[model samples]
Target: FIMENCDELMPDYLNFIKGVVDSEDLPLNISRETLQQSKILKVIRKNLIKKCMELFSEIAEDKDNFKKFYEQFGKNIKLGIHEDSTNRKKLAEFLRYHTSTSGDETSSLSGLRLPHEGEPDRPFYYITGESREAVANSAFVERVKKRGFEVVYMVDPIDEYCVQQLKEFDGKKLVSVTREGLELPESEEEKKKFEEDKVKFEKLCKVMKDILDKKVQKVSVSNRLVSSPCCIVTSEYGWSANMERIMKAQAFRDSSTMGYMASKKNLEINPDHSIMKALRERVENDQDDKTARDLVVLLFETALLTSGFSLEEPGSHANRIYRMIKLGLDIDEADAVEESTSEPVAVPKVEGAEEDASRMEEVD
Candidate 1:
């Protein structure tokens, strides 16, 4: 109807909209300016949204057709969701994503939007990282998926902020499992046990924080960690590791402000991990051992790297590693070797041919 009636009068693209343009009982002779500013435009927009949502619902019902449509216009739908606040929920229905559970390839939106009791009851759970493989294999999502949760693999640079803007969808919250404010259930007994472990590791945490030169906001024991000894987590309302990676990858990154926007990470040590347990014991028993201190620094550096943060002093980290290796080899710390200094051999200047000839003539 739009093309037949308005094609000659409007842009070709605008004519592509397939809908009836009704302006209520207004007079047909109404002025163009009046018609353009009428309340009917809003009503038409609302009706258009409803119609689009209905079309999307029909498309979503068929898996194969939905996949084909998503292949052709998924990005447009995602952009619509990002830009149109009123139709976000409708547009989100058509968006597809790659998931950890669905192998490496992309899957339909319905697959990830479904609910599971063991998994988070939210409409969607997702993780963002540098790449699909990184997000899929992230330590943060390991436990979430182990319980059969379908986590959306967000590899795009804009995805994190886009998801943040979309706090909820269809009465379901969009949960980021990596955020520091993540909600994990814990029994009273478990809470008490964690607190006790925190107390035990308090001194070690302090030493690490001090040696780290305030790079981390704080250090605390984490229950989220299972196998890893330590990992970095941002504070509430701060950029996640994935967001930080994205910001850094930009061509013209504003380091000073981005440094501020990139939340100061907190080093979360897993008390249950052998490395943390051993470090706690060593800090208490052999606190004076230089080797133990080196180990602590190494652990901090390793966590920084894993969390997608750069080391403040890479040279110091290398030196600590070298010292640790030297100690392991039973080498003396004070062992001195004489330095070798050799001067560069100078190239002798050749006499000019003209000067040599003059000299020869003088000699003759």
Candidate 2:
């Protein structure tokens, strides 16, 4: 029937689609042409999808078989999360990844057994990076893990994008705990301090924001960062680092609409970080100093690179490093680098080696 109704049927999409088409109006399906327009075809397609999803869900419920299914069809599940809004919640339930709580191994959704009452069930949070090791050891996840939060190590390129589309799962919000807009509960004292700091650094923050206007949507002091001086975070609605990486790796680099949808990121500096503390002191004491200005630029550029964004001016960072080194060494910034010259040097050459002798003579 499919072969005969090739003109009406979508053949490329029919492969592996196994189902029966029953039409009440057809005389047991009279002819291929007659069956092509049968209203039963629509019902079959819907039923087939429902059956497939049910089968998938059943398989997903089986821990042993779901592992095998995930190994083979995980990408399809991730793609569904990206493309199918209506079914994203269902697809997310099937997705799995390694988490700190999983204890040095990977686990599935069915296996995410939370701790009992009186024990904190810090739902597994995660950040995406190029490697699991990197994500696991990142500064962003360090504090989260310290607080006993189980962070899923999402190294896969699609993991971040897929999770973003799925905002919640099993009554828990899928959160990028590294995002600047994160609202971790803070004490009244900490909140008051944060407000005071914001007021104190208002001018410097404005200046930093102005300088980074093109690359960052905004600049603000963050409570998320602990050890790291600064980090960058995307807007709640923007593409994440992993999404940007996946989009940029596509075959047709500039073709995808996702490339255009990617927006500028926000730079979040830790006010308590030593680097920022020093910067704040310097800005308050001598805001117009060239050295302080250079440090600000360096900090912003470093934040960009650390946050998975490319440096706009690599040379500027290098020069800033040189200047900082000059300051550290108490050397004149103008004379930081010694000029290269072909000046003669006193050196002895081996006898009976005329070419070596000439080379030594040139240096002398």
Candidate 3:
């Protein structure tokens, strides 16, 4: 009976419990209440969890079968990581994920390869997104990949929460690619170039910070962006854009608290981009250029949207876009008439509709 109802006997995190246990030693008078409160039952449950871990370990030894098992019940294991504090490390061993090294294949966290180098091993990198393609093509992953690091693609929504619970696995800290503190190994020449760009773009960065003061924590050149013009990153201890989206979508969550928690983000511009170079020149040459400042604000807001952060002033963004559209089409804003706010005239009642209504009322 316990085997058949193992889900009931086990905790919610262990709901995937299967198989049978036949023991003549259990008391025949073991009522449901007794099973609930008995020390013997506690021993049985502890033994059962141990056996389950052993069985999973055996299954994981065979890649094909483990893949099947993970596909069928991986989310439950992630839930166990979040709920089972006693076996969190063991649960992490069973966690399988899509990693960059595996191509299309998935590998367990323990089985994945650590970076081989003369230097110390870097933190385990991972990216969370709505889809595998979304994470794969992300600007955040570019620098990590360029540095020959493996990044786990976290497609499932539960994956983020799972990593949060299982913070560090096997002495390696898990770091999100979208968050701050990711330092790539740079050559001396590259370092010199970065320093030059920082000094050269210092005023431009300050101008950007001023323009986007309320929306972003700061504006600076990014080490992560290789191809993309700009991207947004969160503070080391703050919630990520993905996390912010998840929290904001919670129906019962307090908006005011979410606002406070999700407010600040950093705008990271690719200083190598041509537009960035031109903007730097423009800012240096004419710091008071309204057009250049508007462009900076527009780029910042666009990056905010692309980086999965919500826009606080979408209407302002739209107006800027409209202005750009006019500029592109060679339409002068000076020639455009302002939209009228005069009260619209109500159409005169159709000639005999009132009389017809009166005749109908008289007939009734």
Candidate 4:
């Protein structure tokens, strides 16, 4: 009954699990470290991982128990998905997320699409944020949710890294809703309608693009906008706002590289939105309309916040908000702040004569 400590056979993620094995295929007196070199032990390790995956599947059958297990040990699963290459697919099955439809409840990656037979084969659409509540209310999911598709809300700190590694599951590509090119499988009629809208809104989008030339790579009529007027989205290869924050927080990240990557963002405008229609009218009336340009700047800044990107020019953002407040209140723009003066105070008739020494010093 010699004790064996073969912890090295297991991944650090599974260190919480304890197990013992007795085999007569190898000598009993062999040290555990030396036995690790044995091909038999390597085979045993492979089998152990397989068994562990099977055990997880069984545990998942009982949803309540698995929820408890996941809440307690879920970080380990995420770490495993990120660090374990050979077993990523198996570990991905254990991934869970809050969703647009699941109201505080969580669903697995496979459950992130419409549950109908005749549904179009959609990719696994998801949004990452600082937390579940933040993503639940994001502008990115508006059209997807309106189209009856569920979106995975990836809120954990490590969820992005884990999903980046997983990439896909069950043959469906995991795509971020915040990515610029979201090609929904539209019917022919829908495509024609979108084409018409694109033509109608082309000039307006161009105006917005020119207004935000330095801040955004492009501005176009959006397929993803249902209720929101606009949103900022990253390019296919660019860092998302969440990923940017993570990398920026790293002590060793290159600022120039990050700046270049972060610059690749686009704005998507809702053709049907009232503000958009009014702005288009304003633009048509005058291409250099100061009010229209100001409104575009405000819209872009607001979209930055709603789309999870921090404002690079917060001072300008604040000033723009103040201007909006003034407009809403119909205050005169010519009203400037009064200047403070350091003119000498005229002590009126010396009520107590306390300033006599200061007045004498000034006279001197």
Strongest candidate by lDDT? 4
The clash numbers for all candidates, in the given order, read 0, 0, 0, 0
What is the TM-score ranking, best to worst? 3, 4, 2, 1
Please provide, for model 3 over 123-218, each residue's C-alpha lDDT reduced to its tens digit, 9 standing for 90 to 100.
788998778887888889888898888999998888878978877888888888898768877899999998888888888889988877777788
Could you tell me the TM-score of candidate 3? 0.86
lDDT of each: 0.71, 0.70, 0.82, 0.83
* Model 1 worst lDDT run, 10 consecutive residues: 7-16
In candidate 1, what are the lDDT values of residues 274-347, reduced to their tens digit?
98888788878867677677787788788777766677789998988888787788887676334356677898
lDDT of 3: 0.82
Which tens-of-lDDT digit does each residue in 134-216 have in candidate 4? 88788888888787777888888788788778888898788899998897767899889889989998888888888888788
* Candidate 4 residue-wise lDDT at 352: 52
| Per-residue lDDT of 199 in model 1 | 88
Q: Which ten residues in a row have the lowest lDDT in candidate 2?
A: 5-14
Can you tell me which runs of candidate 3 are displaced by over 4 Å? Answer: 1-9, 19-39, 336-364
lDDT of model 2, residue 257: 77
lDDT for 343 (candidate 1):
78
Stretches off by above 4 angstroms in model 2 are: 2-38, 61-64, 109-124, 255-260, 326-364
Stretches off by above 4 angstroms in model 4 are: 1-7, 20-41, 111-115, 251-257, 341-344, 347-364
What is the lDDT, from 0 to 100, of the residue 74 in candidate 3?
Answer: 91
